[model samples]
Target: MTRIVVVTGGTSGIGRAIAERFAADQAEVFVTGRHADTVELTAKELGVHGVVCDATAPGQVSSLAARLERVDVLVNAAGGLPETASGDVAPLNALLAQWHSSLAQNLLTAVLTTAAVQDRLTSGSSVISIGSIGAERRGGSYGAAKAALAAWNASLSAELAPRGVTCNVISAGYIADTNFFRGQMSDERQRTLVEETHNKRPGTVDDIAQTTCFLASPGARHITGQAIHVNGGAFTTR
Candidate 1:
């Protein structure tokens, strides 16, 4: 049977790659984004279902869940550093807004979406949430949100494990070929990131995408409630 997969924030970057991977395997893939034009364009290009949804919004998340009757896999990839959160406001208010935006984008997105679609996820299904290496380092708001994501995944895994469903977080390293940095990443910073990795090279979206596919496979049945780090030895746990 073709698996029914849904990827939030699937319009571009890592999310797009994951959606494309599943679609190529002939799964019934649905991709979501915050913009209608981008979502439609990406859907057409990748030949997957597309929905314009702001996963941070409860009403939109619930509506998206209502549209799906059954789901075999769910990838919560809708998150990024907020671009507008850094500006001229009172120092305290600015800090508060930034933190709020970061949590809403990175953590709450997955939480709300998962809660809305929990019923649609069937037995033996998989729930994969994308995390970041910054969670283990100086990520500030973004890092904290990702750290919270890992924490939430543990609880989610426990809740879903009884139903034969698996939930895990993929903590990725600095991956190339994405607008993740929104044009703010400097060449020097990129080199520094690569140098930090044992492989001496930046990671790719495919690396994360392939890992996601494997986690969703039956072979990964016993893997639940775990945060699998996909970084190139950048941040290893002892």
Candidate 2:
């Protein structure tokens, strides 16, 4: 039977790629995004279902759960750097705002969405959340939130393991494509990131998508509650 997969933030970036990958594998893919247009368009493009959902909103998340018949895999990919609040605030206040936004965007989005959909998850289900290398170094509030995500996944994995559900976080490195840079990536910065990677290349959305598919496959049944790094050896912890 074809698996039923849900990908939050599936309209763009890693989430979009993951959804497409699952669809290509003949799975029934449902993707969620905050924007209705983008979500609908992406769903049409990938031949998957799309729902407009802001994972941070409790009511919406609850509704989303009710709308799903089943969720064999949940990819919590809705997260990003905090947007600058008010755009005109002082540096200190702006930083604080960014911190709160980061927590909301990265950590709470996953927590709320997963809690809302926990019941819909069936046996052998997998929950994959996108993480970042920033959580390890040169990271600020965004990293902190991702770190919290990883921590939460550990407990969640244990709680869901008896039911045959698995939880894992993909700690991605510098990935190209998507609006990740917000159109501000300088050539020098790109080169620096590439040089840091042992492979001398940046990561692609497909790289993450393939890994997510593998995690959800039966072959990964034994894996749970782990953070898999996919940064081309940019950061290593042995």
Candidate 3:
């Protein structure tokens, strides 16, 4: 039987790459995005199903859950660096907005999406959430939310393990050729990030995508409730 896989925020970047990887394996892949045009275009280009869903919104997320009968893999990739409004006069209000957006996108999206679709996951299913190395350092609001995601994954794994579901977090480092930096990355900053890695190179979308595939595979059944670092030694477990 073809495995059913769902990837949120799958319009571009790491999410799109992961979706494409699974599609190549002929899995029944579902890629989701907030924009209709992008979702339709990506789904067509990849020959996979597309869902228009704002993963942070509970109503839309539940609607997404309703579309699936069974889920073999759920990839919570619907998050990014918070783009807070900058014109606010009040510093605290702006700060609150940034943090709230960060948590809702990075943390709650995964929580809500998983909660809504968890029952559809049967034995041997996998739940993968995209995390960040920033969670280990000066990630600011984004890092804090990712840290919370890791924490939540621990508890989620405990609850789901008995049911034969495995949950894990992929803590990625500075990956290249993605919109993640949002045009704010300088050449010097990019170079510095590359240099920090032991391999002296930037991580690629394929790098993370491949790891995602491996985790969802049968060989990874024992790997759960852990943050698997894929940063080319940039962030070591030690």
Against the true structure, whose lDDT is highest?
Answer: 3
List of clashing residue pairs for candidate 3:
none
Alpha carbon lDDT of each predicted model: 0.95, 0.93, 0.96
TM agreement with the true structure for every prediction: 0.98, 0.97, 0.99
**What's the alpha carbon RMSD for model 2?**
1.1
lDDT of 1 at 62: 91
Looking at model 1, which ten-residue stretch has the lowest summed lDDT? 82-91
Clash count (model 3, backbone only): 0
Candidate 3 lDDT, 1-238, residue by residue in tens: 9999999999999999999999999999999999999999999999999999999889999999999999999999999999777774598888889999999999999999999999999999999999999999999999999999999999999999999999999999999999998988999999989988999999999998999999999999999999999898998988
Would you give me the overall lDDT of model 2? 0.93
Regions of candidate 3 where Cα sits further than 4 Å from its true position: none
lDDT of 2 by residue, 56-95 (tens): 9999999889988888999999999889877478989988
- lDDT for predicted candidate 1 compared with the true structure: 0.95
RMSD of each candidate relative to the true structure = 1.0, 1.1, 0.7
Query: Any residue pairs clashing in model 1, and if so which?
Result: none
Candidate 1 TM-score over all chains jointly: 0.98
Q: What is the per-residue lDDT of model 1 for residues 32-95, given as tens digits with 9 covering 90 to 100? A: 9999999999999999999999999999999999999898999999999954555568878888
